[model samples]
Target: MKSVARKLSAVTLVVIALSNGATAFAQSKVTEIPVPNLVIYPGDLIEEGMLTQQRVLKRSIAGMPIHRHEDAILGKEAKRTLIPGHPIALNATREPLIVRRGTLAKLIFREDGLEIIAVVEPLQSGAVGETVKAKNLDTGLQVVGVVQEDGTLLVEGG
Candidate 1:
């Protein structure tokens, strides 16, 4: 009778432990950091604390050339004021290319320019009008070409 009672207590303890472990695992959460006010299109050189506005007439005061537009720049403040150029910064929403030297990556061309896609190889250094070698991961083909203003590498072959 004592042995049976011990066995029943051990089973109850095991079930409770398993239930607690399952609850702890299921209650786990992922936290994401808030992005800053910066909008960077592909091929835009990013400086710290720089943002791009969407209007054509609203100029940049920080001597950085405006590359793209944002929705906030279309407000009444932009229309009413004839400010020569406001201080601009890059938006944090856009992800920058992470390229490394001598690593293989795939080049995807968009309407703006090109995007180099590689899981291991991040784009380290590239400029506009400069030729870069991009390799397709699936086909393993090497494509050489010019880097456009929109941050895309225009390969010679299709």
Candidate 2:
């Protein structure tokens, strides 16, 4: 009878321990966040098809990644390797580069029937539709221009 009582008490303790572990696990909340469906290479522009919503452990979000369905992710370029199933961090993306810094570019200007194109070099990098400063290589003039998709800079107020 003594041995049976001891075994019963041990079983009760084991049951209590199992229940506590289960309760702890159940208390942990799951968070929904955006994750890449495919590997996004560095400098690759993000598209809607490449992302999916996933529910993950709340504690797993250590770096404060971009939340799913919260912001527009398309048209952004990955600054680093983006792995599948991992949340895309806010710092991991940037605007796509249209004009590379220090690269030879053409400066275009148009007014009525007059159109001019000059050889210039960008002083800084910029994305399409963004304005950046370029140096006219021939005349050593600095001019600000809007970057175009074709990698040409259109000088403003021309």
Least lDDT summed over 10 consecutive residues: which range in candidate 1? 75-84
Q: Write the per-residue lDDT of candidate 2 for residues 29-109, one digit (tens) a residue.
A: 676777899999998988878988888877767566565553567888888999998877778888899898988998898
Backbone atom clashes (below 3 Å) for every candidate: 18, 0
Please give the lDDT score at residue 45 for candidate 2.
Answer: 89
Model 2: how far is 157 from its true place, Å? 2.1
What digit string (tens of lDDT, one per residue) describes model 1 on residues 63-130? 44432344432211111212223433333223333333466444654344544443222234454555
Quote the lDDT for 148 in model 1. Answer: 59
| Candidate achieving the largest TM-score | 2
User: Which ten-residue region of model 2 has the weakest summed lDDT?
Assistant: 62-71
RMSD after Cα superposition, model 2: 7.4
